[model samples]
Target: MRLTRYLLALFLGLGLCAGPGLADTPGVGLKPDLRLLVDISGSMKTSDPDNLREPAIELIVRLLPEGSKAGIWVFGEDVRELVPHGVVDSAWRERAREAVPQIDNSGQRTNIPAAITAATYDLERLDPGYRTSIVLLTDGKVDVAESPMVNASSARRLLSATAPNLGATGIAVHTIALSNEADWPFLRALARSTSGIAEKAESPQALSSIFVQALEMVAPTARVPLSDSGFAIDDSVSEFTLLVFFGGARNRLELVDPDGARYSANSSDVDWYQNQQFALVTVASPSAGNWRVKAPDSASLRVNVISDLKLDVDPLPNSLPAGRQTELGLRLTEQGQVLTDAEVLAAFDLSVVITGPGGKQLSIPVSREYALPADGEYRIVIPPFDAPGRYQVVAQLQAQSLQRELPMYVEVVAPPEQPTLVTRGQEPPEDDFQAPLLWLGGVLALLLLAIWLHLRRRKRRKLEIWEKRARQLASNDSEPLEGVSADQ
Candidate 1:
């Protein structure tokens, strides 16, 4: 996630560079470029005693110079760059104007880390002359994590990771606390950390002037601090994770504009960065322009940005049985710093079906997006398959066609029983309970036939008896007729 943010910010910093706005910073000629990081977190919509958000927005719009360049970022549970930095043209202003009509401040997550990461990563690609920064105005404290409230400790950790080492980068952070009950310590530390002034909106009236003053802060000496959240060296293999701590509460955060305009971090714009944080990111070797400890604070922590040895998966096993999952051992010197997203492939023969645990076979699943745990060793679970034979396991860099395979003994383990049954002391007997019914039906049919035959025989005998009786009567009549001649 941090890496993605880095790319996004990097694009702005490297691509669409804009010019300066406020020439107020007298002789420096550094007309600061301002990107408003608005705190659209719902509380902003409250029409309070004097509708705080309306006043805040009005104050910001009024202070901008005619050609002031600004970007819009609305941060809440989910932070988004509403507008990216570019020259302040009527088109840009129109976008902002349209934004005001549709934008309502309400989100569940106050993604301070997302905002800061995007801003800082983008800042690095801008010109050294233009002053660029975020003007953050927030009424709440950093609520991060899966919790409803901003996760205090996690928010602090995140902030520490991305907190700009502006003194290291020659930029400054100006912070304004708009709420009465914000984590003063966090805000104060952010300003102090970046060697900028931190102020409070004691009253709505003072909010505007405080913002203007905050903006006027000049750029520090020009220096490029390391950009990767931390350093990633290949001391260990398999996978690695590097932790970066930037204490927003105690450092200056310099912002570089997309269009080369530099601006100080101060104003009514909460999106400008009310604070800073640290993050974990991957990096290539040489570790140029990195940073080390300069100050400490409540949000302060140490980090190791170096390439440690990684658990090498040399001659990595490439193939296994179709229905079995393979386990591999990994070792690491840096322990947590390696690639989890490395693309691993397994190849199978045509006759040997290698369906995955999900039934699909012949797939390249492992890639560079997987988050590598601190342990360099990972148990690569290969889904089971029906085919029983040797298969090849290939470890390749994600997106790179390169691949390494390991041919091994393939044993097709029987698939686990479906509708499996288990009891305390015995195996379930296999019974064909439906078989007896067929024999029972045949016997019933035979018995019915025998009864029908017996009835038929009895009826035939009765008919014969009737015939005999009739004959006897006729004979008797005839004999009698001897006495009475023609009567028969």
Candidate 2:
């Protein structure tokens, strides 16, 4: 009990400091915002050889594209934007170079989720014209707080929450794991979710090369302006999705399928981004032939299409008892076939939304590791419901253009009925007398033991008294016992 109390106290303490606060004030930066999130927690001071982190930052700053704008954020227990995003001129470069050394190893905790969130905020502040990407460098696993609630699962949920923001803003997150202790899988997933890259650095000296590699990944490798000339996919291709990114007011865009079926930006399959800068359309089993597009020539388009990845959640149970643990299954497939290997689908986001009897909603946290344990089967454990009524579990996956929501309803029944034994041709067995008999026997045994002890004590006292009287009589006879009195 004492140990349990101590552990509860510890968790409470951690929960108090779990939040990563907020990011620093907005800095001035345009698109192509390379937000460098460097870990400067106390642990880095030791893991970093000769404190070479600063030198790596200096090298990255020097190599930044002259046309691009950037910012520097250092994260530990708290996130601080050391240098806000600004144009990469000689002056800005020099400022960044000097500011690199100013970042000291003074932080005591490494709040990785907060760092990602802060970087996302920085990119969000920029216009859609500016391509946004983040380069995260860390040497340890997420250690935001020391508590039972702050584990790898918690970190994943935090990442899941921030991933959509990055996706909506088209901000890629590239990560460089500095040491073996780093959460490499989580970092890789974060990068993959945003269409970025993940790499590892053997030592601090290798940081510069890895940073360049990340930069290359974030850089635009190709530019094909889609206007009068539209791209097409042959029938040989299985599935594809086209993401059209633009800026300014909404453009009137049209897509013509191989069968001459016309689809506008308002089509059901087409999703117009709330950001007002992009439209996403998924074409499953694309038909062979030339697909045409019609749009205002003034509107520029950057098209991104991918294939061979799809997420689906298995059917949920029709009914569940209120306040009972229930597991929801999820599956991932490629081209309509379920995937046997879990690693291939680790980059996707799987979450659960629960609606209670009172219309209250809650999102449960899930971990990637849990899915692999069951080979692509994600079992989401739902807490017992408090009221018996209709409850819902909505399983959702946000992977690139293939976002799916699967909701299942279950009617929570009241607690199980108590069974009563029935007998034919005989009176119902009265309450078993064993309990009363046991109690009576216990009382009788205790009374008998007490009486026996009392009798033994009394016998011992009588014996002692007789022995004393006999000794006194013998002594009187030995003393001549008043010889005259005896003769009388």
Top lDDT model: 2
* 30-102: candidate 1 lDDT, tens digit per residue: 4456756656666655522354444444434433444555666778877777766766676776666556544
| Model 1 regions more than 4 Å off | 1-28, 45-50, 66-68, 101-103, 147-150, 218-488
Backbone clashes under 3 angstroms, per model: 81, 6
Q: How high is the lDDT of residue 169 in model 1?
A: 61
Q: Candidate 2, overall lDDT?
A: 0.63
Best by TM-score: 2
Q: Global lDDT of each model?
A: 0.45, 0.63
lDDT of 2 by residue, 1-488 (tens): 32223323543554522322111212211225688999988888777847767756765675565567788999999999888777779889777867887878888988888887776674535665466778888887788778846666667785687765675567777788888888888886776566556678877766655665455444321111243546545333455455443434455677788688988756676443322434445566666556777665545443333333334443333344457776766665443345443333554567778998798999875655354533455666777777977666766655333344444555565667889887766654566676888999999999999999999999999999999999898777445455577549
Root-mean-square deviation of candidate 1: 23.0
